[model samples]
Target: MRAVVYDGPFKVSVKQVQQPKIQHPNDVIVKVTSTAICGSDLHMYEGRTAATPGIVFGHENMGVIQEVGAGVSKLKVGDRVVMPFNVGCGHCQNCEEQKSAFCTEVNPGFAGGAYGYVAMGPYMGGQAQFLRVPFADFNALKLPPGREHESDFVLLADIFPTGWHGVSLSGFQPGESIVVFGGGPVGLMAAYSAVLRGASEVYVVDRIKERLDKAKSIGAIPINFDDGDAVEQIIRRRKGKEVDRAVDAVGYQAVEKGGNTEKPNAVLESLVRVVRPTGGVGIPGLYVPSDPGAPDEAAKKGHLMFPFGKFFEKGLTMGTGQCNVKKYNRYLRDMIISGRAKPSFVVSHEIKLDEAPVAYEKFDKRVEGYTKVVIHPND
Candidate 1:
């Protein structure tokens, strides 16, 4: 079998690797059909994380069950399914409470686990011909059989639900206005989710015109931070009114306007500035405890000079963490099946497994039209 293997900083390759098997009685083997390269994957690809060579690089995955273990009962061979990036053991306290993202049993000593991500877990990623799914009954979301929603269904494995989780964390209410920082796939989905939830107004902030255009296409008002201060831009558009909520999707890799400089807390600071007093902010963006590529010693150690004084003065609320994917994937899946959602709109390219390396390069560079790349491993 072939899988996308991380070689080093700014490097990845699709190479032949050992295929995964049913290692546990509760496991199942899946023949991967579709997988996606997430922005978080860039963290590892750029050597910011502890990811080493030969790490299979994928987490957003969906496919057909090729074989089921003896312990699997509800699912069987030929079941179409999508597994959340989070690898939960299903019986842990967190998993029992539907917070599968922080399952204590999967990645011991860590609060959460994710497939193919550094420090997440030991599970090999699904960006290959086949993948091993542990606790199949709890980890895999059974999808309606067929290829009809292939593009959209695969998104349910990660970004779609993650975006929704960001909005939910903000305690958003219908008719409230929100601004989402970053216009990548997850950010776009956050804006889309806001629209579907009946937000009075949706604002997306990004420097890229392509991404801003996509946000506009989805009824979100796009704010190009490169043009000016992002908070000022949003406030001007709202006629001096701050938004009810904000979401930070850019995370620690955020760059300042008109510069290549990395500011680990740029998005978080902007969220504090643009959200109305007493309003809330949701952060689904990936922030790490350490970054080998950070620009400063403080950031290298995961410390940011947060605007806590302003945050406290404004009486704002904040929610931050990995998305408990299982908490929202099922409902979001039904939204896709009913045509209420089409996350595939953000998918700008669909390439074969062999093309993954190139896709990763372009996507990492934020090249125009590389908004999202979905890999069809078995195509």
Candidate 2:
């Protein structure tokens, strides 16, 4: 089997690795067809988190089940399925409440678990020829039929619903205006969700023209932060009407609004400044408790010097965390199947497993047209 293994800071490689097997009674071994490189993966790739060398580098994944364990009854060896980024046990109290991301049984000491992510769990990632899924019946959502909708269906594993979840967290109302920082895949999807759910206007802020162009393709107003203050651009576009909601999809790796220097809290401060008084903000971005490789000492310990006073003064509300991908994957899948959503539009590159190392390099640098990259492991 071939897998993308982390080598060190700013490095990854496609190398031969042992194939996965059923480890638990509820486990299933999947022949991975599609897997995505998430923005959070960059955190580990850059050595910002605790992801050590040799960890596999994928999480958002979908494929056909090749083998099922004894206890898995709802699915067979041939069912097409997609596993959420988060790992969960079906019987946990948190799982019962539809908060699968925080399932108490997967990673004992932590509140959440995700495949191949740093400090998430021990599970190997799906960026390989095969992947082992635990609690298969609970974690793997069966696809409707064949693999015809592969690219569209794959987004259900993470970013698509995560974008919707961000809007939900921000208490988005129909016909309201919203702004999203960072025109990366998640940000583009967030704008798409807002557009689909009836937001009157959607604004996406980023310096990358390719990303901003994707936002435009989805009918979002692109705010070129490099042109000027992003908040000012938003205000100018809306004729000084403040946005009702905001999303910070660019996390700790965020740079200053229009500059290249690292500013971990830049997006948060900008959101606080731009959103209307009493508006809501959602942070689907990744923020670590401690980032030893951060550019500054304060950010190294995950201490953000944000404008808390402004946020508090305006009475703005905030919601932040990893998306509970299971809670919405099923519904999002149906949406794609019904032709109501086509998340594959954001997929800028689809490469074979061997090309993952180069994809990582280009994507990490925000190269033109590399909005999102998906790896076809079995290609």
Candidate 3:
């Protein structure tokens, strides 16, 4: 079994590794069909996020059940399913509250567990021939007929649900205006989700032309931050006032022009500058407590020089966290199946498992035209 193994900073290799087996009564062994690279994995690949060497490195996955543990009755052999990025125990207190992202029983100190990557727990990544999914009945989302043609449905494993989470966190109401920072897959999804939820206006800000163009094609107003000051453009668009809501889809390790490295104050600061007082923000971007390469270690404390005074003055609120994937996936699946929303439009490239190394390099560099890369493990 060849799996994408993390070697070190800026390194990965598809190496033959021992196959996984069901280790828990509630686990299910899946023969992975498709897996996608996530921006979160770049953190580990760059060694900015704390990830161990030799660990598997993919999270977004869709596959067929090869075997199921005794405790898993809801799923059986041969069922096609999409595995949520986050693993949860169905009966936990957090799960009961519909906060499956913070399930208490999986990783103890951590709220939840995810396949592969840093600080996420011991679950192996699914970018391999097979994966052992724990609490399968609760976490594996079963797909309906012909769902594979709807390759976009697999995006629900993370990006689609996450994009929806960004809006849900923003506390949006119909007709409110939103400005989404970053034009990555999640960011694009966030804008699309906002439109689907009836936002009066949605602004997608990104330095990349291709990404911004895609956002435009989807009926979103594209703001090219690289063309000029993003804040200025957004503030002007909102009638010289702040937007009703803002979303940060750019997480840690955000880059800037002129080759100057700095902490990600752009998204947070823009949220403060553009979101009107009394409005809220939804931040689904990956913020880490520490990144070795970040320009300011002080900023790594999860404390940024945020506009606290303005935030308080404007009576603003903010929501931040991982997407409780299971909570939104079922609904998103229906939306995709019904043709109401197509999240797969974000996938700019499709590659084989062996091509993952090259694709990852291009994406990590934030290269032009690399939005989302879907890796077919079976290929």
Candidate 4:
């Protein structure tokens, strides 16, 4: 089998590797059809994380069940399914409470586990011909058989639910306004979710013209930070009214306006400035405890100097963490089935498995029109 293997900083390759097998009685083997490269993967690709060489590089995945283990009863061979990026053990306390993202049993010392991610778990990613799915009964979401929603269904594995989770984290109410920082896939989904939930206003901030245009196509007001301070741009566009809520979709790798320098807390500070007093902020972006590529010593240790004083002064609330994907994927899946959502709109390219290395480089560079890249491993 061939899988996308992490080679080193700014490097990845689709190479032949050992195929995964059923290791537990409850495990199942999946023939992967579709997977995607997430922005979080860039952290490892850029040597910011402790990702070692040869680790399989995928988390968003969907496919058909090829084989089922002895204990797998609800699911069987030929079941079309999508597994959430989070790898939960199903029986852990967190899983019992529907917070599968933080399952204590899968990653041991870590609070959560994700397929093919650094420090998440030992689970190999699905960006390959096949994948080993543990706790199949609880982890895989059954989809209606067929290829009708292939593009949309695959998103249920990660970004779609994650974007919805970001809005939920903000305690958003219908008709409330929101400003989502970053216009990448997750950020666009956040804005789309806001629109579906009846937000009175939705603003998306980004420097890229392509991403901003996509945000506009989805009925969101696009704020180009490169033109000026994102907060000021949003406020001016809103006629001096701060938004009711804000979301940070651009985590630690955030860059300054009109420049390429990384400002780790740039989005955090902007969220504080743009959100109304007593309002809330949701952060669905990826932020690690340590960043080897950070620009400063404090940031290298995962500490940022955002305006905590302003946050406290304004009586703001914040919600931050990995999305508990199982908590929202089922409902979001149904949304796709009913045509209420089409997150595939953000997918700009669909390439074969062998094209993954090039996709990684282009996507990492934020090249125009490269908003999202989905890989079809078996195509």
TM-score of each: 0.99, 0.98, 0.97, 0.99
Cα lDDT, all candidates:
0.93, 0.90, 0.87, 0.92
TM-score-better candidate, 3 vs 4: 4
* lDDT, residue 379, model 2: 84
TM-score of 3: 0.97
lDDT of 2 by residue, 1-379 (tens): 9999999999999999888988889999999999999998898898877778889878999999999999999999889999999999988899999889898889989988888888888899999999999999999999976778898888888999899888888989999999999888899899999999999999999999898889998899998988988998788877987999999888888887555788788898899989999999999988888988788888888898989889889999999888999889888888888999999999999999989999999999887578899899998
Full candidate order by TM-score, most accurate first: 1, 4, 2, 3
- Alpha-carbon error at 209 in model 3, in Å? 1.1
**Candidate 3 lDDT trough over 10 residues, lowest sum:** 254-263
Better of 1 and 4 by lDDT: 1
Stretches of model 3 off by over 4 angstroms after superposition: 257-260
Clashes of each: 0, 0, 1, 0
Worst 10 residues of 4 by lDDT: 251-260
Cα lDDT tens digits, model 4, 103-137, are: 99999899999899989888999999999999999
Which sections of candidate 4 miss by over 4 Å? none
Worst 10 residues of 2 by lDDT: 256-265
lDDT (10s digit) by residue, model 1, range 270-310 = 98999999999999998889888899999999999899999
